[model samples]
Target: MVIDLPFIWAALIAIAVLAYVLLDGFDLGVGILFLGYESGHQRDIAMNSVAPVWDGNETWLILGGGGLFAVFPLAYAVVMPALYAPIIAMLLALVFRGVAFEYRWRTERGRFLWDWSFALGSTVAAFAQGVALGALVQGIPVENRAYAGGWWDWLTPFSVLTGVALVVGYSLLGATWLVLKTEGKIQQQARDYAVRAGVAMLVLIGVVSLATPYLNPVYLERWFAWPTAIFSIIVPALVLGCAYLLFSGLNRGYDLQPFLASLGIFLLCYIGIGISFYPYMVPPSLTIWQAAAPDDSLAFLLVGALILLPLIIAYTGYAYWVFRGKVRPGEGYH
Candidate 1:
């Protein structure tokens, strides 16, 4: 049935989003943290840590988008048009980031320029994703399976808050990554940042959780349903415990714990959002079945995914394995 297809599509989309958050999230965090501290050596270490895997992380974002377009053309028709401007802005930010990483060391004067590019790009990209996500949550102006409102409709206050929240969340992920990958001073500072970021995330998520029901009563009823509430509480509690372990591990100078904790947090958060949306791909607007491609199209896409998805997964795994271990200085990301 079409219902099964949406669930399948939703699962795929969630994986892509999770992949982006995990892979690109750390690099973006490092970029923001780079601005806070004045240590060139630390910056090099941070950049080196993500260089090998950052590009691959972005692949999933593309895959997610492409797959959505391919498998759910109806969904794309509505969401993409509604989100035209922000999506364009997000792409520009990503382009800036890709180029900046390459040109960062082209010349001495290029240092500040590239640094700003990387930092600003990361900040903007994170914000753009959050805004798009927020707008989806807040409901789109869709009528008869088409986007109704103009471009600026995404610029709501709730969307802005989601943008800021995602930045803070990425910073937490970056700090935890540093805690796992670095040693001595950088690791220690990263630990401090992780703790701070974790605390802030808790507060922000709390506020968001409280506000969501008020923002949309439908979401409130969906989330507040008895069995669903239990699962939601359990998963997030586990995430909180993971955060505690990260702090404890950092306190004890446990190298691997921080990154593991970050991963757990991201996973839990992804799951929570998945639950929040339930049947809707674009909330308050289109249910996933309402937004799917035809059965024949999904079948064709499935054939391609059978080949392509595994290749992507295998290559991604291999790349991480090759880049395993700590990053070293004087080694350009190239």
Candidate 2:
């Protein structure tokens, strides 16, 4: 069956966003867990847990951006222009984290610098992305698909809230990941953080879910309407179940279960967002209908995805298989 261009972009962006979340999710999570470590040794362990596959996972981000640029060139034109400054900042942070990853273990003097840089870079990048997301959600000053605003235009209460939320979200992901990767003191610290972060995240999601709907009546009507209310109950129920498993797994020393549970929470949140903005890729400024590529573009890209997606899945699975094990002392980060 053939679909419209808007549907194609919607589907592709959803895939891109999911790839970014899962691929970079655990790495950003590592930085979050870095703060939970007692020493550089534990830090190294946490870092190494993700090092083997983290960079490979980044191909999805590149692909996501590239796919968007290709399929929804219009969105690229609109969003990048409105978001030039923050996007640049986000790229810079990504650069610093990449640099710090390589430089951290060369010497003692450089150790502290690189360690702080990694954490700072990760934190800033997460916050910046969140702000950009929030700005997009809250809408930018645009006329004729071009930004018509000053430097401070993107700075708003909603955008600031998004920055904080993304930090918390990343920290939650990191804590869960540590629970999966390490053991003993590091494991316990990670477990503790996961439980706390889980609870905090649960509350934050609830508040945001409620508030975001009110942010736009279009959203409000969609969420609060009849029958769709069924999903409302189901989504929260699933999230709560995951939260329950997270704490239960943490308390029982169940190792990887907490991580799996946290992932469930993140995935559920992803679903909620997808549902909330079903037809709108660029809220208040553009609809997915307005921003999609042509039919020929979708067909070409979709064909490539069918071939490449499976290979990506296989490689990611194998890499995880190869790297699976408790990180040992003196093993060091690559």
Top lDDT prediction, candidate number = 1
TM-score of each: 0.94, 0.94
Candidate with top TM-score is: 1
Q: How would you encode candidate 2's per-residue C-alpha lDDT over 1-334 as one tens digit per residue?
A: 5567567656866786787877687788677557657556888888887778778777788878888888878778878877877788888988988888889877786687888888888888888888887777766555787667677767788778877777788788888787777778888888778877788888878877777787777777777798776788899999999988888888888988888887788899888877777677677666776787777878888888879878887888898888888777777466
**Clash pairs (backbone) in predicted model 2:** 29-174
Give Cα-based local distance difference scores for all models.
Answer: 0.81, 0.79
Tens-digit lDDT string for candidate 1 (17-55): 788788888888887776665547777788888888888
lDDT for model 1, please.
Answer: 0.81
Go through the candidates in order and give the clash count of each: 0, 1
lDDT of 2 at 120: 82
Q: What is the C-alpha RMSD of each candidate to the true structure, in Å?
A: 1.8, 1.8
Q: Cα RMSD (Å) between model 1 and the true structure? A: 1.8
